[model samples]
Each structure stands twice: as structure tokens, then as C-alpha cells.
Target: MKQVLGSCLCNRVTYACENNFSQFHLCHCTQCQKATGSAYAANLFTDVDNIKWLTGEALIMRFNVAGRSISNAFCGECGSAVPYKSLSGKALVVPAGSLDCEPNIQPQSQIFYTERAPWFDSVTVCKKFDSMPK
Candidate 1:
């Protein structure tokens, strides 16, 4: 089976997951935007049992939105996103940005498109810089 490694920003937390992802979703919902502090969240969905924490498991923190299905997890030390089981208890949601390598699957769909931010629409048309502005 394929495997992928992931780490938090400070490298305080590390993990590995069997790349058995069934879906890749770019969520534009309001909750997802707030949790990621970005235009959208790239998440990979897989069975909850597929992940294994390599280190800093104690530093992982999870938050579930009250009365909502939205939830997220992060590394306590670096505030970097991490994988967590979905509220439904069926699948694990892995933050694509946290992965050290790309997964086999590409994004399957963009959800909550109607809730997307106005500025998000023009991002694709903006200049693409290879690196930091100089």
C-alpha cells in the first residue's frame, strides 16, 4: 500500500498515512475558510484507521464546531493543520498542505462554492510568482 508522511510547521508533530484516500475535496465553506485561514481547505478523505502518528501525538489539538459537522485539528506548538477523524466517525480528514509528498489522487470536487469568498474568484487570474516577491 502507498504511504505518505506529514509534519507540522515546527516539525513538532509527524505522522504517516496509508494513501488509501477515497476522495479529495476543496471545501469553500465558511467554516473551512476560517479553520484554514485561507480561501479554501484541501482535504483528503480516508478510513480513520489508515493514519499512524510518528511523533508529538500529545501536541495535537482538535476542535469541533458547536452544533456543526465542521471540525479541525492542528499541532499545538506550530499551529499547523493535522489529520483528524471526521465528525461522522467514518473517515479521517487529512489536510493536504500538511503532507510532505503529494498523494496519488487529485481534488475530486470543490464544495460549498456558493459560500466562497468574493476575492477568491480572481486569484486564478492573478500573476503567478515562482517564489517570494523580489
Candidate 2:
């Protein structure tokens, strides 16, 4: 599979990873929601060594949720989420939005479904728009 590139909104942090992902999940857990500031977090899991930092490696910052396993790494300049190793260091977690191209696989499942935001279901029935509704 061809390698894919990912970067932050400010283009300060960049990385490359192969399209070989083991799992993709949309997590509705509150922590994930809070971390992403969204209804859920779409994450792709791959081997720990799957990612290669291409630029601004030193500018990356990480926050480990103390007493919990959850952690997030992002660009210090733009605060855009990036790939990081899991607490166990068993796998690399990539924020789906950071990717330059779509993944080869679709989301395998919606994890923590019970924890989904209350308004999560409203979007399906809500008016669709390419941009803000006029």
C-alpha cells in the first residue's frame, strides 16, 4: 500500500504512514468527545512504528490524562490532533481528520455507543449542507 501523509491545520507538524491500518473506530466516550470537541473521535489504529514524523517533531505536545490511560498529542502551535502511541505502546492512534486522504478501510464500529452525545442522532435527520446553511 502507498504511504499517506498527514498534517496539522497550521501545517507545522507532518507525518507519513502506510495505508495499512488494523482498525478504525468512532468512539463516543465522553473523554474522546471532550478531547475532540465533537460528538465522537474517529481514530485509526496501526502498528506502533507505523508513523514517521516528517517535520516539526519537536513542536509536538502531549497530554496524558493522569490516572487514566487516555492521552492526546497535537501540534503545539495549532493544537491539531496527531498520531500517538497508545498507553501500552502496543499501537499508534491516528486521528482520522489529520489524514490527507481517506483510509483504505471504513470505520469498523462505533465504540462506547451508550456514551454517545444526546444530540448525536439529530444530525441524521437534520438538514444537510455543504457549508453553513443559508
Q: Rate the local accuracy (lDDT) of all candidates.
A: 0.94, 0.94
- Candidate 1, residue 82: the lDDT equals 94
Model 2 C-alpha lDDT per residue in residues 13-131, reported as the tens digit of each score: 99999999999999998988888999999999999999899998999999888787889998999999999999999999999999999998999999999999999999899877899
What digit string (tens of lDDT, one per residue) describes model 1 on residues 1-134? 88899999999899999977899999999999999899999999999898999999999999999988999999999898999999999999999999999887999999999999889989989998899988
Model 1 vs. true fold: TM: 0.97
Q: TM-scores of the models, in the given order?
A: 0.97, 0.96
Worst 10 residues of 1 by lDDT: 12-21
Best by TM-score: 1
Q: Which stretches of candidate 1 lie over 4 Å from their true place?
A: none
Candidate 1 achieves a global lDDT of: 0.94
